[model samples]
Target: MEMQGEERIAARRDIVWAALNDPEILRQCIPGCQSLELKSPTELSASVKIKIGPVSASFSGDVVLSNINAPESYTISGEGKGGIAGFAKGGADVILTEDGDDTILAYEAKAEIGGKLAQLGSRLVGSSAKKLAQQFFADFNAAVSAQAAANS
Candidate 1:
């Protein structure tokens, strides 16, 4: 599956970049995220629970950020196991550009699933993924906006 989208954050590029890389902020933005640990500058371990269609599962995964361009763009990838439910792996290329007083965050993502998750059919899985992505960005935008407000 493939997905791409963008959001305008009411914050500067640097602030947005910093927030995006922060585990605390990510944990708040990620839907059903139980924990997020930053193992290194570019590595993270996480546990998240999700319900897609009729299947509900908790997934533990490792995320790695590549092609670091400090405050500009990077590629993030990870894979998760959902016990008997299935497994999922995905990667996203994210870019940030300054737009007036805001930052425009753009991303292109691709994902693949196996086992029971794959059996759920592409339409259902894809729809769930899209909703999840939307929810993440909405939360992210709100968090960044609030942070920016607090700093001002």
Candidate 2:
């Protein structure tokens, strides 16, 4: 599955970029994210609990950041295992740009799944993945917006 969207943030580009790279903000915005830890400046580990149709499982994943330009753009990729439920791996390319006093955040991502989740059906996996991605982005946008408003 692939997902793409844009968010208009009421903050400076540098602030938005910093928040994007902040482990705490990422953890708070990711849906079902139980925990997120930064392994290094360029790496992070996350644990998430996800439910799709009748399957639910906890997944632990590692993410690596590359193609990075501080306070601008980067590419992040990760994969996770969910025991009997299945497995998932994906990556996203994110860009942050300044628009006058605001920030524009855009992302394009692609993901794949296999095992029980895939065996059940691709449609279910795709739909659920899309929904989860949308929800996560919505939460992230709201989070940044709220923080910017508060600071302003």
Q: Which candidate wins on lDDT?
A: 1
Expressed as tens digits, the lDDT of each residue in 1-152 for candidate 1 is 99999999999999999998999999999999999999999999999999999999999999999999998999999999999988999999999999998999999999999989889999999999999998999899999989998998
Candidate 2's C-alpha lDDT?
A: 0.89
Backbone clash count, each prediction separately: 0, 0
**How much does candidate 2 score in TM-score?**
0.95
Candidate 2 lDDT over 25-106, as tens digits, reads: 9999898999999999999999999888988889998999999998889999999999887889999999998999898889
All models: lDDT? 0.95, 0.89
Instruction: For model 2, name the residue pairs that clash.
Output: none
* Candidate 2 runs further than 4 Å off: none
* Runs off by more than 4 Å, candidate 1: none
